[model samples]
Target: MSASSLKLRMMIVTALFAAIIGVLAQVTIPLPLVPITGQTLAIGLAATILGWRYGTLSILLYLALGAIGVPVFAQMSAGVGILFGPTGGYLFSFIPTALCIGLYLEKTSFNLKNAIIANIIGMFISLLLGTVWLKYIAELSWGAAFASGVAPFLIVGLIKAVLAAWIGIMVRQRLASANLLYA
Candidate 1:
C-alpha cells in the first residue's frame, strides 16, 4: 500500500475501534459493586487486531472523542471532566492497556494461551492504575480503593479478556483471509 493508503487505513481502523469501544461502553450490567462493562473486551479486540501503535491510537481517539463532549464513556457520560474525574484513571489506563496487549500479540503468535496472558497483563495494569487513582482522588485508603475498583471486577475482567482474545483472533484471521487486515 502507498503511504497515503496506509495512513487512511490507520485512520479508518482507529475510528472503527473507537466506535466499537463507545458502543460497548453502553452495554453495562449494573452490579452492587463496580458494574460490568464491555469496554475492556473492545479494548482487547482493538489491541489484538490493530497492534500496539494503532491500537493505542484508537483508544486515544476514543478518549479524545469523549473529551470533546461526545457521550462515549460509560453511562453515556462525556466531557473533559470525566477524563479527570475519579474514574479517569481507568479511562486513561485504557491506552497503556491496549498498548501492552497489542505489543505482546504483535511479537508473539496470536494463540489462545498467548492472548489470554496478554489480556491478563493488560487488565492488571488497568486495574492497578485505576485503583491507585481511586485511592488518591477519592481520598480512600488503598484497601478501599482495591476493594471497590479492582477486586469487584477481577473475575469478570478475566472472562471478558479471554472471550475478547478468542473473538479478536477469529476476526483478525477472517480479515486477513479477506485481504482486509487494515494493512
Candidate 2:
C-alpha cells in the first residue's frame, strides 16, 4: 500500500477500535464506585491487534468522545465530570494500559504467552493507577480503595486479559496474513 493508503487504513482501524471500546464500555455491572465493564478487555484486544501507536490512538479517541459528552462510558455516563468521578482513574488508565500491551506485543512475538504477559502487565498497571485515583477521589483509605476498586475486579480482570490475549493474537495473525495491519 502507498503511504497515504496506509495512513488511511490506520485511521480507519483506529476509529473502529475506538468505537469498539465505546460499545464495550456499555457492558457493565453497576457497582457503588467502580463498575465491572468490558472496556479493559476491548482495550487489550485493540492494543494487541493494532500495536501501540494505533491502539493508544484508539483509546485516546474513545476517551475524547466520552469527554465531549458522548454516552460512551459505563452505564452510558459521559462528560468531563466522569473523569473527575470515582471511576475516572480506571478510565484514564486505559491509554497507558493499551500502550503497555501494544509495546510488548510490538517488541516480542505475537504469541499466546507474550500476549498474556503483556495483558497482565497492562491490567496491573491500570489497576494500580486506578486504585490511587479511587483513593483520592473517594476520600477513602488505601485498604478501602483496594477493596472497592481493585479487589472486586481481580478475577474478572485476569479472565478478560487471557481472553483478550488469545483473541487479539488470533486477530493480529489473520490481519497480518491479509496485509491489513500497520507496521
Q: Give each model's clash number.
A: 0, 0
Candidate 2 segments whose C-alpha is farther than 4 A from its true place: none
Mind giving the per-residue lDDT tens digits that candidate 1 earns over 1-183? 676876786678779999999999999987543467889899999998787888898999999999999999988989998888788988999999999998898898777788889999989998999888878988898888888899888999999889988988888788666655663
Candidate 1 stretches with Cα past 4 Å from truth are: 1-3, 31-34
Error of 2 at 129 (Å): 0.4
Leading candidate by lDDT: 2
**TM-score on alpha carbons, each prediction:** 0.93, 0.97
lDDT of each: 0.87, 0.93
Local error of candidate 1 at 1, Å?
4.8
